[model samples]
Target: MEALVLAWPGGEHAFRLPLAQLELLQGATGCGPEFLLNKLNLGQWAATEPFEIIRAGLMGGGMDAAGAKDVVSRAFDRHP
Candidate 1:
């Protein structure tokens, strides 16, 4: 399954999942990230954190999951 990651302003991140997950996520929120996360039982992660990291990645033009995680952690340390 191929996943396309989308990051938007105002702290929004979406994973364009493959057909199966897409079906599930779409049903929950019509192709929105919050809906997908809720449907996939990952709602606990909270959209703000991932979205902030994603926003950073998108702005920098370097999107890597591990790198995003690292950036998120550092951001968390500074802000939290």
Candidate 2:
């Protein structure tokens, strides 16, 4: 899968959805990859889906668990 690099609050970070992350995401959302993607595309996701996806992707992109969680927390806040 391709990595999604974005300019976050502090700096640019790369996020990815590998198999392991995908599986975790599926479990968290109780949906398959296609369904999840569709939901995201259609803007039908639940409140936590985006956060989960970003956290998982950050981990998949080689960020440590704590770092990923911190980044997701900061990025998902009310700021831009």
Candidate 3:
């Protein structure tokens, strides 16, 4: 599958959500991926949604666990 490249505070990173990651995301958010997508589209997403999505996507895109968490932390600190 194609990856979505996103620019974080540190640098650009490729993000993807395979089935496994999506399942994890759903569990984390207590909602399905479709509902999350809808919330994002309508600009009504909770703060944790973007964080969870980005972290999961980064992992799915082959980033190491530490690296993904660091990137998300720095990015959200600046942008949030």
Best by lDDT: 3
Give the least accurate 10-residue stretch of model 2, judged by summed lDDT: 71-80
Best-performing candidate as measured by TM-score: 3
Poorly placed runs, candidate 2 (over 4 Å): none
After TM-score superposition, the amount by which residue 29's alpha carbon in candidate 2 deviates from its true location, in angstroms, is 1.3
Better of 1 and 3 by lDDT: 3
TM-score of decoy 3: 0.87
Which 10 residues in a row give candidate 1 its minimum summed lDDT? 53-62
Clashes of 1: 0
Ranking by TM-score: 3, 2, 1
lDDT of 2 at 45: 91
Q: Total clashing residue pairs per candidate? A: 0, 0, 0
Clashing pairs in model 1, backbone N/Cα/C closer than 3 A: none
Tens digit of lDDT per residue, candidate 2, span 1-80? Answer: 67889787888888888999999889988988899999999989999888888888889888998999898888778463
